[model samples]
Target: MNWNQALFPQAGPLRVVQGEARREEPSFFPPTHLELQLQGAPDAYGIETTVSIYPLAALLQKYPEQTEGSVGQQVKALRSLLENPAPLNTAAAFRLPAIDTVNASLAVAGARKSLSSANLRGVRYLGAFSQDVRRFASTDVRYVFQGISRDGRYLVTVNGSFSGNVLPTRESLEGSGYDVAPQPQDNDKDRARYEGEVNTYFAGVNSTLDQSNSNPEVTRLDQFVELLQLR
Candidate 1:
């Protein structure tokens, strides 16, 4: 099932990350990797949504020798999904291909996110992630999820962000003009001033990290995940 079309009246960006090379590790093959970007609520920063779906049979048909024999069997291949929460923390990723290509979005915030054990209706061993970007006028943080379906038929991922926040990449600090970009002719004093500004900005983000306030978007997206039915 193509969730992009089903979830949105008009979906966006479902590419195979062009120039993808077959990595040395078959487990890191490229078939299970994908990309997308969806515009979401206007208020949330970097809150656009993007979901990637990869069909397992498509993987097998393309690389039968590389996939696990049992999973390749297609009839009883669901064993890959880790259901038990105890060992879920140590579980490896869904064996989807590695994303090694470059993307063209200029980012400002650190590529830091908090991850914990999580599961959606259609998938198990899913990891929930959130980034701290000094959210303003909105409780929404950039939430993301990635894991394989319970039946091992597909790999599913969800990144809640919108077209409004897609460009400039780092909505937290870069595009906000709080920490001004250093000019090519910046002197030592100018560099120090910019560094101080960035430090202050991150301190605010750290304060958010210390708070325990709940994000409503996480629950909303979780329900969306639970309702997804992947064949």
Candidate 2:
């Protein structure tokens, strides 16, 4: 998939190292070979490769104090769905696509795990939007799943939404005081400061996907999921 289009659709500008100095410019990184391959996978799975849910700000305001708790419950429920895929296969609302994509990746990676509906959890919705959005009136929810290979040699954690657009967009970042605009010339000192700001911006993104520590395994699963997504 086009990571830039999916994750940074509204991204303004980014800082990059151009020669010895840094330059702030609107950058466009072509989709890598791997990304292209994954994107070309069959669509029989019935899952939306790029999921654009509602905004996080609306969800927080709607859930308020119960956000974390609500998300935890949603995760647990999704795990149960993974353990049982029968409902997913028959239920149209589940959107539980076939595991061919995941399984194929595992095979290429020499993982013995066979991703199937039985072992894979259905993506669950964690939060919802308070207001409607034109014809698309859906809530912003988090999706996650964990599975172990048949031989247990590899554990698979899938933080659903392959695009990594789980958090707010650049517009939201700008509203939060982030320098979404590019810097024309970045010195060493300016780079350091900008890097820190960038880190802080990501921290906010992390917080949006952060779940409670009640389940340590889930946390580890999330970490692994992130690793796979990065790859």
User: What TM-score does candidate 1 get on C-alpha atoms?
Assistant: 0.40
Best-fitting candidate, measured by lDDT? 1
67-186: candidate 2 lDDT, tens digit per residue:
322422333433455576555323322233222122111100100122343222233222211121111111122233434333322223333222222444434544564343244255
Q: Clash pairs of candidate 2? A: 45-97, 82-121, 129-139
Q: Which portions of model 1 show Cα errors greater than 4 Å?
A: 2-29, 32-37, 40-48, 56-81, 86-141, 162-214
Identify the leading candidate in terms of TM-score.
Answer: 1
* lDDT of model 2 at position 33: 13
lDDT of 2: 0.30
Model 1 C-alpha lDDT per residue in residues 1-231, reported as the tens digit of each score = 344245455556556654244555424444645665645555534345666666656755554563342224321232332343343323232232121211211112222222323333222221212232222322233444545665556656676642212223344444465323444245888777766765564444434432322334354455556655554
Task: Rate residue 53 of model 1 by lDDT.
Answer: 68
Global lDDT of each model?
Answer: 0.41, 0.30
